[model samples]
Target: MIHKQVVNHRQIAWLVGSLLMTGMMISFLRSVVQVARMDAWFSQILPIFYALFIAYVLSGLVEAYPGKNIFEILFIIGGKWIGGAINLLILFYIWIILAIDIKGAADFLHISLLPTTPLEVILLVFVLLMMYYGKTSLEVAARVNEFYFPLYFIMCISLYFLLVNEYNVERLEPILTSSLDRIVVSNFLPVGVYGDIFLIGAFLHAIVEPRLFFAAMKHGVIIVGFGTTIMLLVLLGVMGFMIASRLNFPIYILVQQIHVTDFLDRVEMILFSVWFPAFTIKVIVAYLAFLVGVGTFGGQRHYNTFNAPCGWFIVVSSIFGFPNVAHIDQFISYSLPLIVLVFQLPLAIFLLIHVRRKNKGREQSLIPEGTKLYRFYRSMVWITTVCLSGCVIVILIGDFFKDKSAVGGIATAIVFIALLLIALLTSYGEMQALNHGKQKLGRAKQAGSFRQ
Candidate 1:
């Protein structure tokens, strides 16, 4: 058996910070702008709720499986064929995420930072940095997170202070009047943005304790959610929702409104400095996930060999994914539900169920015990499932048939998501039962060995 390396607590904390903030920076706010127009900030409630539910369920699944990463769990649940199929889906999802990260970074820089810099050069630097870091182990990634988070947090706080003068409460005054339907229908932006938290399951085996899974995730979500809500509020208040939605970098636009006297007119640069590192961490995380998925799915060998090819694929695919930024914007707005259903939800439910079933047979005979923290995690699946189900229900109700002009199609979408969430939860509940039994047996075996 291959020895599994463990990441330390500090690094794990950083990893969580990097992942959470990365979600905030990449597509969440921008996607919201594309949908609800001036009302995008307010419209985010539905998607935020949905994304949180998905995050909880995804974390719960990782908790239930103990030492298995998502790929191994897939195989256990569906056998080779079905599991392979699910893996393939995950592979594609990772690919898309990497592509988006690359493109978003390059695009943001080109539009805002170094306007004349070649896009290839910008993307190449990022890809190389990620490739170097990706090979360094999860410990390295986490270490970087811990090292940089202080500076990152400080810069973020300073940014808020710099821009505080620009806020306008009148802009957010008419929060709910945009035809409740329109406000609801526009929430796909945040949903698409935050739902990527599901990808963290790829690292379940790499973390110290699976029980800490939800703890880390819940903390991250609250941070991102609350931070985002505040940022959006600031954006709406400062720039007015109409103007805020019109700017490509809503944050940048807000930064420009800063007036801490004429001396600090270029505060946007400071914001970019803070924002750039956060963005780098996002790309790094995506690249790391891609490398791991390749290694895990390719029979657990040659991770380094796969890095260059995967990086190149991210480069090429990003260039080809959309004709231009407009298309990317449109896709983020309308195609989100399809992406969530086909990729995030199905895979999560499948893996959770698969693990539970396999755990059932192990109830009779067990081997050396794993971590105690991991066992506590396997027990929490039912509680998580119930909470997640309720959250999903709220999202569906809030967002369902939100397109008043296109009520029929919207209702269909709502019903479909509801059905998917239910199926996933029921399937996962069964798997949790099996996983719990396996843990019990394993404990028994350990106890007998101790007596001997």
Candidate 2:
């Protein structure tokens, strides 16, 4: 068995966030934009929900059976024959994906950077890196993710923030114009990308505190999910869905417009430098997970033993797997979602069926509505309600000012802003009233005690 690594919750969370950044920009963005159009930003909601639920369920299962990962759980719960079959299936899935990731990274680097360098050369270098990663401990891999995620995060955010000038809010003007069926379909499109978080099941054994594994996974996923949501919006907000959807990598082209100063013109390379590592780390994590799973399943050989052989195998398969960019793109765009669901649904059902059920009420009581997470969501809920209400009011009252002139537009803007402010003030007033009431009750109780 591979040694347990002392990785903290925060560090692993960063790994999850880092793993997601590259995939979102390169692959996940354009596909959703094509289907959802203006509403593509909200498509992240489905995957986020699904991913978190999977995390919660998987973690709960991990906690129930201490020290054992889901793969091992399959064996214990089902015994060798049946469990081994399922285990092999999951391993097979991971191996296919790991190979695909290696190829995808090579393809990306070849097209974006070392065009003069042969593809096989790039593939060789990448496979060697994965071989090194596979041979290393989980702690080492986590540290690499820790370092790269922030650099990737800052580069993407800074470049996008600078593009505020280019963002035409009108590009996102007509919301939910797409049919209901289209919106639901678009939501499922990104599931394949996000469902990779299920690989967290492989990561459970490495965590220093396995109990908090789900918490770290959830936080990490939230960062990715929200970040991805904002990224899609920005892509649509700056470049209309028409333009955003057409490009294979909208974010790359989007960053090309980042000519901050005369000297800093064409700094997409800077962003690319950060993003390349970001993408590579994602592959490393997936590769490492596969290796770790392999190590545990055998109980005899070290995971590192397979790393070189498997890495070379992947190198060859990757070259063949992605015959061209279009082939991989088609596979990812269409085939991937089905594969994700096939793996995800069965695993989830199996865990839910077999996992040790903890005290439901006790668990619910632990995270009261007053907690930071719940409060933040409550505040967001209120804000969304107020904004949506304001929009509806504007639409309803907007008919009165039928002149589609500058005056009418200004009036609509003013009305929307006014209603939004009023709603916010009312919510604020309610909060103050509740606080005042609590303070008054405290004083009254003090006086009553003093008299006694």
Candidate 1, superposed: residue stretches over 4 Å from native: 1-5, 8-17, 23-39, 43-52, 55-64, 150-160, 354-452
Global Cα RMSD, each model: 8.6, 8.1
The parts of candidate 2 lying over 4 Å away from their true place are 208-211, 357-452
CA lDDT of 272 in candidate 2?
Answer: 81
**Which pairs, if any, clash in model 2?**
none
Write down the worst ten-residue block by lDDT for model 1: 364-373
- Cα RMSD for predicted model 2: 8.1
| Clash tally, candidates in order | 3, 0
lDDT of 1 by residue, 275-346 (tens): 677667766766777777778767874477787888877887788886455666556555755797667866
> What's the lDDT for all of these models?
0.60, 0.68
Please report, as a residue range, the 10-residue window in candidate 2 with the lowest summed lDDT: 359-368
| Structure candidate 1, residue pairs in collision | 77-354, 168-237, 356-431
Per-residue lDDT tens digits of candidate 2, residues 146-236?
A: 8778787666556557788898878975555565566677878778777777776776666533335555665676567656766776788
Predicted structure 2: lDDT:
0.68
